[model samples]
Target: MTYKLGLTGSIGMGKSTTARMFRDMGFPVWDADEAVHRLYASGGAAVAPIAAMFPTALDNGGIDRKALKLALANDPEAIERLEAVVHPLVAKDRENFLQKHSDSPLAVLDIPLLFEKGSEWQFDGVAVVSTDADTQRNRVLSRPGMTEKHFEMIHARQMPDAEKRARADWIIPTDTLESARAAVERICNEIVTDA
Candidate 1:
């Protein structure tokens, strides 16, 4: 069976880049964020229910993520409600991914909230990318619409980088593209050999 590799990192920690490296290295990746976006754009499966909960976020064709952000901003309970609707959809999609890729020698689940969502149980092993705090802060703060206050709020919701580093079965410190890809290749080779 394919190894179910779980990959995660904090915001601005190069998760998208790492996920690309994994894909380049030929591992099938199930991206949870993409799944969420899919659900958002998909039929009335979950979006309508979510719209019922937060009406301002849905319109013409799909959910307006920015509008949803505005509605949920500063409202902790609003986030909980959003998660209640979206998480299940993501979960079912993840299960579908696993089932579809069951025969591959290695598969990856690119889950941003893997730890926060208690999703470790679904993986053969977890790899977390880490970088220095200053690097992370600068990288995140450079993004459009990313305020320090919002960064802090998101960080507060996530497991600390240090703690995530400590908990990971494999740690990839992504300071550069080449080095990060090397680490991903190493992990892939290791998993393929071991499996």
Candidate 2:
């Protein structure tokens, strides 16, 4: 049986990089962000429903994230409505991915909001990628078009890094790339060996 490992982290904490490391080590990874991206793309399952819900969010036959953000800007409940439309589709996509990779010894599910969404229970184990607050702040601030206010907004919505670490089955600290890679290697080996 394949062991489903949920990987998560706040923005700029190196969750994506760690997920890639797992992939490089031959682990099948289902990325929720990528799933969402595909769902919002043209010809995706979410496009039609989202279009019906927020017609102004479509751009060139796809759901435009910026437009969607704008649509949600004024209404406090808009995000909840959008989530209602997209969440189930994303869950189905994740289920299909798991079925497709069922032969694997282990698989990784990279979810940015794993804890917030109450998804931690679905995984056999959860790994939280983390970094020092200063490092996280620096990394996020360095991103193009990212501002302090935007970072604060996003951070406020996510569980604190310390709390995530406390709840994690494995804490993957990503202070440096080398350290992060080693953690990935170690975790992969441990999982494979135990399986």
Candidate 3:
């Protein structure tokens, strides 16, 4: 049986970098954000449903993310409505990935909202990439087009780092690449050994 590890962290917590480390270590990694991007691409499974719900958010043959963001911001309940349409499709995509990687010794699902969406139960273990609050804030704010309000909005949607750390089977601190890589190696060694 493949050991399914759910990898998660709030925005700017270095989750993507950690996911890459896992991939580099020869573990099959399924990225939820990438899946969503695929689903929102032209002719993707989510296009038709999302188009029907938010016509203006469709550009050419695909969903325009910026337009969709604006639409959601304009409507107080649009996010919930949008999630109602997209979550199941994302779940299906994830399931397909798991099926494809079923033979692997270990599989990592990189989901930013793993805990927030209550999907932690699907994984054998959960690893949370984390850093101090100041580091997280500084990292996020350094990105182009990221404002304080936007950061706050995104931060508010995520579970607190403390809570996530408490729930995690392993906490990988991403303050430094060396530290994060060491943790990844340790986790891989431990899991593979146990298997």
Per TM-score, the best of the predicted structures is 2
User: What digit string (tens of lDDT, one per residue) describes model 2 on residues 96-154?
Assistant: 99999999999999999999999888999999999999999999999999999999999
Query: Which ten residues in a row are the worst by lDDT in model 3?
Result: 70-79
lDDT of 1 at 94: 85
**Tens digits of lDDT, candidate 1, 1-195:** 878889999998999999989888777899988888888884746789878888888977578888888889867788888888888888899889888888889998998988988889879999998888899999999999899999999999999888888889999878988889889999999999998
Clashes of 2: 0
Q: List residue ranges in candidate 2 displaced over 4 A.
A: none
lDDT of the structure predicted as candidate 3 = 0.94
Q: Give the TM-score of candidate 2.
A: 0.97
Error of 1 at 113 (Å): 1.7
- How far does residue 75 in candidate 2 sit from its true spot (Å)? 2.2
Best model per lDDT:
3
TM-score of each: 0.92, 0.97, 0.96
Colliding pairs, model 1:
none
RMSD (Å) of each candidate, 1 decimal? 1.7, 0.9, 1.1
Question: What is the Å distance of residue 10 in model 3 from its true position?
Answer: 1.3
Q: Which residue runs does candidate 1 get wrong by more than 4 Å?
A: 42-44, 73-76
